[model samples]
Target: METILFFIIVGIISTIFGKSKRTQGQSPKKPIKVSGMEDIRTLFKELKNEVSLPAAPIKSEQKVEVLQKSNRTLEQEYNQVRKESESSRKALAASRLQREKMKEQTIEVSKDECEPSISMEPNAQTLVNGIIWAEILGEPRSKKPYFPKRG
Candidate 1:
């Protein structure tokens, strides 16, 4: 509550001060200009005038020779890299093809390895006999035929 009252009092005082500053006829404040900017630019221009670095001697024929040699070397390196990249791409493609072929071969082998589990159709008598093992064993016998019978 004290903080609220304090803020309200401050707001009223600030509003009065702001209105006085805004409404009272007063002369405009002059803009402050930074000094030394022109001097710095004059110094820079003088330096640019004083310093005369002659261009490095570049004979037209030598320039052509260096450029030609560098171009040839760059072209050769580019060709080598392109050749290597091409070979790597071919190798990757071949490896992927081999991977696909191996997968297909594995599927084919698995299919060949798997055989049919039973004769075409189990007879009615065989099916009934298979289930009767539970009654014969007497102690809730379960899937005894499914468990291979001992000789």
Candidate 2:
């Protein structure tokens, strides 16, 4: 409301000055409005251009090339997978053959272990036979007693 009152006072002062100037034989020039400016049209044109600017375009060619590269890498990976699978098959076959050979020699290992091949030197009967005598005398120490040869 105060702004409107201030504009009203300024308008009345301008009217009074116009009348006084007219009485002195001088016609007052009209105050120019915004229509007189040359740059106003260009200002509107710049605003319209800014509003019409296009959005940035999304590119897909680089992404497509990356996908193709990944496909080639997957192909190489599958080749390596196949080679490792063949190696594992060969190792498994060799292990099965080795297991069969060990099974066949188990009988010989048991025979050798059951009867150890002792030497029959002259010291064997005296030294080892005295141990047999000591074991026969120590029979009562065990749950089941043992006796030496009667002969």
In TM-score terms, which candidate is top? 1
- Model 1: per-residue Cα lDDT over 34-141, one tens digit each: 566778888998888667653576689998999999999999999999999999999999999999999999999899889646677899987897688656766543
Please state the error at residue 137 of candidate 1 in Å: 19
Model 2, 32-66: lDDT tens digits are: 55675657887888889877874554369866888
For lDDT, the strongest prediction is: 1
Per-candidate TM equals 0.44, 0.34
Worst 10 residues of 1 by lDDT: 25-34
lDDT score for residue 9 of model 2: 100
Q: Clashing residue pairs in candidate 1, if any?
A: none
Misplaced by over 4 Å in model 2 are: 1-69, 115-127, 130-138, 141-151
True-vs-predicted CA distance for residue 106, candidate 1, Å? 1.0
lDDT of residue 39 for candidate 2: 77
